[model samples]
Target: MLTVGLLGALVEARRSLELSKPKTQVQWVDLAAPHGPVDLALRLLGDETPAPPSIDPGLVATWDHIPDHGAVDRMLQQALVNAYGFVVGYTDAMHQVCRWIQVLAHPMTQTTNVRALLVGPTGVGKDLVARTVARLGRRASQPFVAINCATLPRELIVAELFGAEAGAYTGLARRRPGLFQAAADGVLFLDEVSELPLELQPVLLRVLDEHAFRPLGSTTQIAFHAQIISATNRELASLIEGGAMRADLYYRLAHVVVPLPSLAERADDLDLLVRYLWRQVDDSDPPEDIIAEVARRAWPGNIRQLRGVIERAVLLRKTVGSTSSLLDEIKAAPAAQPVPSGTLSELRQRFERDVLVSIVQRCGGNIRDIARELGITQRSVYNLLKRHRIAPGK
Candidate 1:
């Protein structure tokens, strides 16, 4: 019995040691630099090696301690990447959306008389910002109703916005609340507001002014007090000039016009957004050159194009294990094989002159640095500058 007791004690001691011993030395690679949340996680896990005894293991007791580990971070990152891509991805998806909150609180946007309009190119996150603001507004608990003016038939536009009474129209069998009535004291986001037909504009204007609309076949009016946010990609000024949009409705809805900038305008934010998205996909550090290549491309579709490019790159990266060749292939593709009318000598002269001028300007008149950057002798750069009729700085 004593021998068995001793054996049991030994087994217990072994189990405790196994439980206490560091399982596997977790080396979290810092994808971002120092002070980055991901880097903080890496530091807590120790510096790419087994954690020292002096380090506190309790620091990472919860996954929330690691910024990249949270589910919200993953979901938000993916959504931002898929929805807006890099560059304007985070800024457009989050920062611009958040601005609506501040705008809602501002005196100009808070007044009952003032309406807000969000204007930008399609897929530039105009509607997304409106929906996000509505979700975060004080009336979050109330219903949020959204109507796409462009999608509604002209005949039903009034009924959709102001409800219909029983037997009011051919198909109206029961009383139904319109979006505006259903969203009372909440929010009504009208997308593509410019598409609202010219004939129905007066009714919309009346609703904006009186905050009340009578259902079809009903003499009594129903009151609706909902915040109205409108969005459009079309140029309202042009539309008004063309007599497509009501000037009065435009004035009322554009009390606070927020123009969202394109992704190309905020290219510097691409790297940060790329890292954020990579982490979301549970990917380690992506090659720096791949990110640089993405930054160089001109995304005409703006954030939407960037996301498609990234999705392709990620898929290629997974299958090929290298993005350099993919980048090279993209670069090597013949650039529209130019019209084929110019002489080689003429093109050469034009190219040389342009390059020399650019290098000189970039050097800020320092010929030495210009020569180094261009990988040529200082005298050669000076000669090219002279040939191009450019004066060198003393």
Candidate 2:
């Protein structure tokens, strides 16, 4: 059972996700009341109250990033550059994302929920771009929940998504709302969607098509009003070809596909990225020569690797002098390597094992908490533990 404190926190979080935007055709109804679930359930049983005032999405668009228009476009561009610390680059890829956001916010498109897919290599800021787009939408002030699909096990995917009721499965002692319901009036970002299991794909498809889903143990269906922004480092076509993904679901989520350029493809942004990363690591301004030197490398790990390099440099500077040459260190470090290709089943199993192991270690082998967080039954958790040779905590 949820502790009184925990339940209060959940209610507070739900309140924080309520929208500031006026009602639209696809606007989410905040069924949660000011009090706890019992009050909310009672209130929901009453006659539906009239929705709040309606606002034109076009008016909301006034704050959006207009790709190629006028003063608004320029301001949006400047804001993005500042927000990203000018590391996103001035490439066409960035422009395309901005353009897609404008189209996504149109009154016609805004009449329905916007489901966007971001495709690119890992560590290329796909999640960052998605969040930026969400920030530009009418639901900017609402919650922005991001889940790494690649990290979730197949058995827990459904539970992590739609939530579960008490007695839904072994280990679930109380009801819990999933990411979809938690992000009701906002954006729910599913990162590395290419890793999603084929079995759960249809469940996601149903929710996307019908905007409704049943909890793990519930008869009543819940409405899903959050905009879904999915990202993947791998090609969906390849996943579909290998029977690892569903084509129908792909088409639905890919309505607005924004492909991010890899770091190698946008070398021009390296200097800005270095400087930005350096400032984050060390509060002081990075030397121009250091930034220039760091920018000349072929960063195979993309921004994620680059950030690590900068962080290491900061440590080295503290230990040695500020003039520490990192070239030798960079050369000694293993190059960014691609994951070896394998059969879909083999790859999925390995991925699941690794993710489960990591989470188990992080959570200190708390089976109940793991089951709750992963949205799986205790039986599934035990199965994973047995498969991976993990000993559950006492």
Which candidate tops lDDT? 2
Residue-level lDDT tens digits of model 2 in 43-74: 11111333235523333331123343333223
Query: Per-residue alpha-carbon lDDT of model 1 for 253-276, expressed as tens digits?
Result: 887888776555556556755666
- Stretches of candidate 1 off by over 4 Å are 1-100, 105-113, 277-289, 312-394
lDDT at 258 for candidate 1? Answer: 81
Write down the RMSD of candidate 2 (Cα, Å).
Answer: 19.2
Q: Specify the poorest-scoring 10-residue window by lDDT in model 1.
A: 1-10
* Whole-model alpha-carbon lDDT for candidate 2: 0.64
lDDT of model 2, residue 344? 54
Clashing pairs in 2: none
Write down the lDDT of every candidate, Cα atoms only. Answer: 0.61, 0.64
